[model samples]
Target: MTTASPAPELSLRDKPGFSDLQGVTVEHGLNTQDMVVNIGPQHPSTHGVLRLVTTINGEIVKDMEPVIGYLHRSKEKMAEGRSYFQYQPTIDRVEYLSSFYDHYVYVTAIEALADLKVPKRVEYIRMICMELNRITSHLLWFGTFLLDLGATSPFFYAFREREAIFKLFEDITGARMMYNYFRFGGVNADAPPGWLDDVRKVINELPFRFDEYEAIANKNPIVMDRCIGVGVTSYQDLLDYGVTGPSMRACGVAQDMRKTNPYSCYNEVEFDVPTATEGDVYARYKVRMAEMRESIRIVHQLLDNMPGGDSAELRKLEKEHAKVAEEIAAAKKRVTVAKKNEEAPNAADVAKMAEKAPELPFDYRTTGQKVNLMVFKPPAGEAFSMVESPRGMLGCYLVSDGTPKAYRVKWRGASFSNLTILPSMMIGNLYPDLMAIFGSLDIILPEVDR
Candidate 1:
């Protein structure tokens, strides 16, 4: 007899990539059931201890719920328990990549409440540190983002440049990562001898290195394929979600706080807020790349025309201060002796000597107003200050009970607001594209959980 009737053709859902989940099926005979996947809480691509409760159908992500709080260190609560100065060191851990920005917001918030005036030189130094920090932070992002996409060489290249900057930091701040160098009205110490020159040499060489990195990773077919069309959102969507920094700038919105609201010496410096209209992962990449160059430009300008004189001039000023201080002290002592003893030679002359005594040449501009930081207490009022940090607008809100410690402390970290948009961007994107999209956001976990 004839061969058995051909078996009924199998549905497309029965193919290799498809998996049957009970009997659920779509109109085309494709499986419609969803599969849940946990991408993090211990994964590498997450960049931190973030858990993504992702739902997928076959290879397509249907939904994503970010599970945060894993890295929470009770940073905000700690401020209330410690004196203002005591809490200064802990701020470095909030967003360790750009802790200078953290210190700037916290210190300046208290400065506003206390009516503390930061010197122009201190402002210039702070601006320099911040822009250099921006470069380092972006370098790390550059390396890690590409590494997530399967490229390895850029990681080492990035760290090589990062180490150079860290060495400069070590020379100035005495610590690389946890730099508690900023203070209420001035920096903790002036830049060390030749430190700025070292910074200049290192900063000058970075652009060439950046060029090399681009040559290696920028045009790779895999990078372009994965990044160009993936993870796009509308300009309105970015603003609606409260996204900022390079992520929002990628959507063709130039909403940089540095440009919109100038803080510190940013008004004095000249640079462009790099932006792109693609709203995709590649657009974000290009924005940050341009930003690094802009930061370099800012650093060069500040260094060339640094407000404080060179180290040699500062040394001379210190010597002159010592001599003038001695003269004023002796004059005051003579006046006191003459007042106590009527027989002392010419009481009127002694008084005249005290009046004519040279005033001590104290550089309040460098040393600030010299307040007692240990018991420093601001007035009973609230104040908030914000700065354009590498991530976005980093802000600090403080409530003071006219006490040595803060009554309430709040931080508005850019990563926290930026992370909210991930689920919206990720849904409907392929599972493999998750890293490409998430990395573009550059969400650091401490900022999210703090």
Candidate 2:
């Protein structure tokens, strides 16, 4: 019983296996102890529901881990039950900010499967709308980034121009934010008559509007101090993390999906991929601003050389097909009545009329269908498609099981990869500098968690 007092009764708190404070420790050699903090799922600067668990040694972040999944919507699972046509609308939810680009990728994949050929005029229209959407997305990013850095007025100014672009989309697609416009063979509808003129007016006003925004935010000393030389992402880091779009261009990489991959008539357009050597927050900002200007230039060119044709030819084709079907039904009904009245035509008479029936010509070479509008079954294979979304390279890897729905769908979101490098940038930075780095990444949580 005396046995050294049974080693002080071996309290549960002292045992390694049972102790609640198993890994807790205090620094012995450091001048000041580090503190653990959470930046938040509620912090406005985080852009969405994101929590950063960080350890700070004074103002410098010693370690950080990002906690996500709060905005998860199970979009891929939702796509499984939807028909190919039905799923087109769901793409708008993947990256809510750049809904058109998301729709473009999904529609393009279906187009490839169905072997649909889009008209040249339709291609040009798609390019115009996509470029405009690109500019709008960039505008929102610029405004929000500036807001995170404590600037207020630029957000309003950027949104004013962004709203004009949204109105144009709404005019054509009939939906402002999430436009389920792009279809398997073509767009939902043709652009309105005065839409091109409205585009030109916005393009004309943008240069003056951009100049005003630049004066307010780009040249300000505070903005320069907060952004320049801060959150530097090296060219190699960008490549390693698979960053694209403005973020990669900011690091001096000239990889633009619109240029390299060249989808939706992007190759026909002439525009520069703006780049910067610094790879800092300011460089990303500069690249985005320059991109908006390039978008404006492309819009101007598109307006000047906008193709003129029966804009609603596709819709007309659908209507004509419907009419022909109705006529055929009527003829069948008449034949049935003639038989009932004992005046039915003989085989020779029926043959003569069949010979005279005009053949309905449908361009099915591109769309892989004999009829212009028909439910299609994609081949049992997989395809990967990428687009230059405002954030970065948005890619969709889809597998079809010879069914109406996709067997598997994987979204390679650029925001998810871009945000992975944030901790490295914030490692030795001050508290406020965190906002600058986070803002520059331009991450949308829905895109990541989708």
Candidate with maximal TM-score: 1
How well does model 2 score by local distance difference test? Answer: 0.79
Off by over 4 Å in 1: 1-23, 26-33, 331-364
Q: How far is candidate 2 from the true structure (C-alpha RMSD, Å)?
A: 10.2
Candidate 2, superposed: residue stretches over 4 Å from native: 1-31, 309-374
What's model 2's lDDT at 136?
88
CA RMSD, predictions in order: 4.2, 10.2
| CA lDDT scores, all candidates in order | 0.87, 0.79
TM-score of 2: 0.81
For residues 1-450, could you state the per-residue lDDT of candidate 2 as single tens digits? Answer: 556554456554444434244334333322444688998889988878999999886777878999999989888888788777777777888888888888777777766765677755666677788889988888998899999988898899899999998998889889888998876766666687677777888889998998898888888999999999998878888777766778789988889887887887677779898999899999999999999999888878777765553335444655676676676655666675765546655556555655666432332112223333336678788878888888888888888888877887888888988888888778878867998888888899999888
What is the TM-score of each predicted model, taking all chains together?
A: 0.90, 0.81
Compose the digit string of candidate 1's lDDT tens values, residues 1-450: 398998888766665455555534453455577789998899999988999999987778889999999999999999999999999999998899999999999999988999988887788888888999999999999999999999998999999999999998888899999999999889888887677799899999999999998888789899999999899999888888888899988888888888899888788889999999999999999999999999999998888887655665676766776686686666556655755544445557656755765542333255568878999999999988998888988889999999999999999999999999999998988999999999999989998998
